[model samples]
Target: MQPIGWVLLILAIILIIIIIKNFQIVPQSHAYVIERLGAYKTTWSTGLHLKIPFIERIAKRVSLKEQVVDFPPQPVITRDNVTMQIDTVVYFYITDPKLYAYGVENPIAAIENLTATTLRNIIGDLELDNTLTSRDVINTKIQVILDEATDAWGIKVKRVELKNILPPREIQAAMEKQMKAERERRAKILDAEGDKRSQILVSEGLKESAILKADAIKESKIREAQGEAEAIMTVQKAYADSLKMLNEASPTDKVIALKSLEAFEKAADGRATKIIIPSEIQSMATLAATLKEMVSDKNIDISPKSEQQAQTTETNS
Candidate 1:
């Protein structure tokens, strides 16, 4: 082959290589920053893009997907002068590829430094206790600060988290002891409350039992009184029934007198300080005694008269 033909073939090969190099395929969730003659030109999104070889070049390939960065532990001093190691995790994403490429020299290093500085500032304002307890507040403050600071760099700080906050070994031991003591105190209080509840329940049960016993005693007394009342009524009814039958029979005065005597005998059988007999009863008693004496004298005199009469009649005959 001739020298000019070989030179032409070499130029064609170089041109083909340049064209292939100029073609770019931006992948999903990715961006490409283009620079024209060392100056910012444009940003290419996810798709095929062409750039003039040797004139326009890709300055940076930015990933638009959310990313995570865990910074190393930083030594921080609290307001109370307690030193501790705190590590942070930041979640971020690229919002603008052009700005992220040209806005800062080392964006990741800038973010790490900013995070450290912000953490120190926040820790400086809080005591050890507050620093341990206020994780959410610290995280929110850091996120807000980082978002505002990184906005010009085309990065959006989605979230910031304190991954770990490690206190001194001595302080950790002391905290463990304090937590143990607090738990024991709570346990004692709970036990006391349980005992108090048990005592109250027992007292209530005893009170209820006493009330039931009193009610039972009261019911028994009421029943006993009712029984005595019924018995008295039965005795009175029997006496009334006997009196009614005697009246129905229409007894003579003598019989009534005898009944009265029987009633007086019954009254005498009972305990009494005095006994006052009625005038009718006194007259009946006196008549009974006089009749008894007259009958006795009649009997004695008849026997004697009969004997004397018999003797006198025989003498006269």
Candidate 2:
């Protein structure tokens, strides 16, 4: 072939190659910033995209999906003048591709520097102990500051986190000791409270026992006094009733003597073996005279026949 024809053929092949390269297949969560005439232009959303051969170019590619980046440990000073090392992580994504590509020279470096400065500013206001403990607060503050700063760069900071806050070994040891001492103090207080309660219960029981004893003593005294009064009343009533019965007089003296003599004869009839009548029986008219004459001669003896005759004579008289 002629040289001119060969140059034309090569030119055609180069053009075809350029067109094929310009045909870009963007993923579901990605975007492409397009530039026209070496200046800022529009961005293409996800899917197949086309670009002008050389006049329009894909200057930058931005990811619409969230991305995670880890930061190395950084030394920070707290308000209490305590220094600690903190490791962090950040989640971010591009919302506006045009600004992300054209607004900042280096978007990632800018975002990282802004995050570090904001973290220092926020943490400087907190105490060392709080900074070590309050991860949620730190994360929220960091996210808010980062979002505000990165907005112009078309990056939205979804979240920020302090992965770890490491205090000095001496501070950690002191904290552990303080916690242990607090627990021991609580235990001692509880023990003292329990002991006091036990003592109070014992005292109450003793008091109750004493009250019961006193009550029993009081009741016994009342019962004894009542019994004494009842005994005195019973004795007095008996004496009064006996005096009233005695007030009703008996019969005449003759009748009393006769009944007394009859009772004495009946008693003696069952007890004595023999009886003797005095020779002067007519002289013995009173009971005392009769008794005295019958017993005056204790040695007098009589035969069984004489005793029987005397008994018959007495019966006849």
Candidate 3:
């Protein structure tokens, strides 16, 4: 309630506010660059930090997390005097907050300019074709150079990528035409190979068919020959059996003569230009004619007595 007591309480409140403001808390993946008396002091990492209110101040707040920066397209000349525009992307992280805060006035701007200059130098050594094709080589070279150059600035270049390489319209058209022709050539080669393979398969199939046909023919001929052999054997066996049965039957001379006559008759029935009769068959026919004439004569007796006398004469002859 007194004036001095009120003034003392107000001063205590102001001091407390100032002290609390001086107690800084650095967050994760961040650092604080502290300067004492407008000179280099120390870097504060992620934790509670206290600084003198007017003498010690935070010069810069640096993020320790990886950062990506895409630089604008820079016009460059190749070894072949071809002009092109290429943009790049860089990945970096802060390593030392103190160096980053004091080493360069604008670190991002410095990196962009450095990247453009390095790109031009590298492109100057390569032809238009090599520059277009060798992306990995160019990226590695740029990353290495940037990492070394940015060491003093407390930055580490992790990766460098050529985001876009824009060539002239004419060059792009020519490349597309060349690629189309290459694809056509490969397609023709594949078609030719397929045709050749199909022909080989057809020829193989024909060869197999021919082989099977020949085998069938060979088998048919072999079977026909075997059948012919068996037929001949059967005919010969039948003829031999007939001869055996005939010999087993005992017959008189007249019966034998009749059988000979039957055989001669069978031989005469064929279409022969010439036929020769045996002398014995001719004599037997003459005797049969004489017997027939005697049987027809009226003076000759036709009884068994005459028949017996005729048979007795034939037997004696």
Candidate 4:
């Protein structure tokens, strides 16, 4: 190769290197802080940017997206002098790349220190119980303070959270025991309430059964009384019908006397110590005995004798 050709090739390679170094493509959600002549120049956003190769350079690449930082546990004392270890997580984003590059030497380290200091200040005013319970209050206070303080550094604190608050080992064990006891008590109370409800349901069912049974018994008694009354009415109606039939017959006196005799015969069949006979029945019985004697004698005339006895009975009456 010729020397002139070699020199031309080296110049072409140097030019390519300068072009590659000077031109930059900033990615999305990122900003490049540029410094020219050892001073802040401008911030390059998400686009192609050109800079003088040696005079202007990227000082820092600041992410514009929201970011998370998990700080280590910081030991703090409560108002009651109880020492605890608490860790924090911060959500932040850069608002200005120039300020982020020139505002502070180390923005993350400054934020960590600020978080620890603010946590101590808030926890120191509360007792052990309050410090354990009031995590939200502490988080809000820390977030407000950090946001105000980091504004100069082009950082906006979106939120602060206490990742963990670990108390002493003995206190943790005691809290676990208390929680277990409370759970057991709730279980017992629930069981007792269930038993009470079951008993009440059982008693109500029994009471309803008893009432139904009583109602059935009452209905049965009413049915029995109705049956007895119906039987009595039937018997009385039968007696009334018999009397009406007898009255409609319009019997003669002889037929009436025969009927009376049949009644007397029926009464005589019973085991009565004494029986009273009416005077009319006695006269009829005497007349029947006389007629029977005359018929057996064969010498007495029945028609004339019967006429003479009837005349005598009528005159005597």
Compare the candidates by lDDT and give the number of the best one: 1
- CA RMSD (A), model 1: 12.7
Local accuracy of candidate 4 as per-residue lDDT tens digits, 153-183? 9999999999999999999999899999999
| Superposed Cα deviation of residue 184, candidate 2 (Å) | 9.0
Instruction: Judging by TM-score against the true structure, name the best candidate.
Output: 1
lDDT of 1: 0.85
lDDT per residue for candidate 1 within 96-178, as digits (tens), equals: 88888889999999999999999999999999999999999999999999999999999999999999999999999999999
Whole-model lDDT per candidate:
0.85, 0.78, 0.84, 0.84
Instruction: Count clashing residue pairs per candidate.
Output: 0, 0, 0, 0
Off by over 4 Å in 4: 1-6, 208-317
User: Per-residue alpha-carbon lDDT of model 2 for 1-317, expressed as tens digits?
Assistant: 99999999999999999999989898888888888999877788878888888789888878888999898877888999888788889999988898888779998878778877888888899998788778899899999989998899889999998988877789878988999999999999999999999999999999999999999999999999999999999999998986565456556656556655565456344545455543333233696565544334333233323433432112211
Q: What tens digits encode model 3's per-residue C-alpha lDDT throughout 1-317?
A: 99999999999999999999999999999999888999988989899999998899998999999999999899999999989999999999999888888899999999999999999999999999899899999999999999999999999999999999998889889989999999999999999999999999999999999999999999999999999999999999998998788788777777777776566445434433233434454356565565445434412222222323322111110
Lowest lDDT block of 10, candidate 4: 308-317
Q: In candidate 1, residue 295 scores what lDDT?
A: 32
Ranking by TM-score: 1, 4, 3, 2
**Alpha carbon lDDT of residue 48, candidate 1?**
96
Candidates' RMSD to native: 12.7, 16.3, 10.4, 9.4
* Better-scoring candidate (TM-score), 2 or 4: 4
Poorly placed runs, candidate 2 (over 4 Å) = 1-7, 176-317
Model 1: how far residue 145 lies from native, Å: 1.4
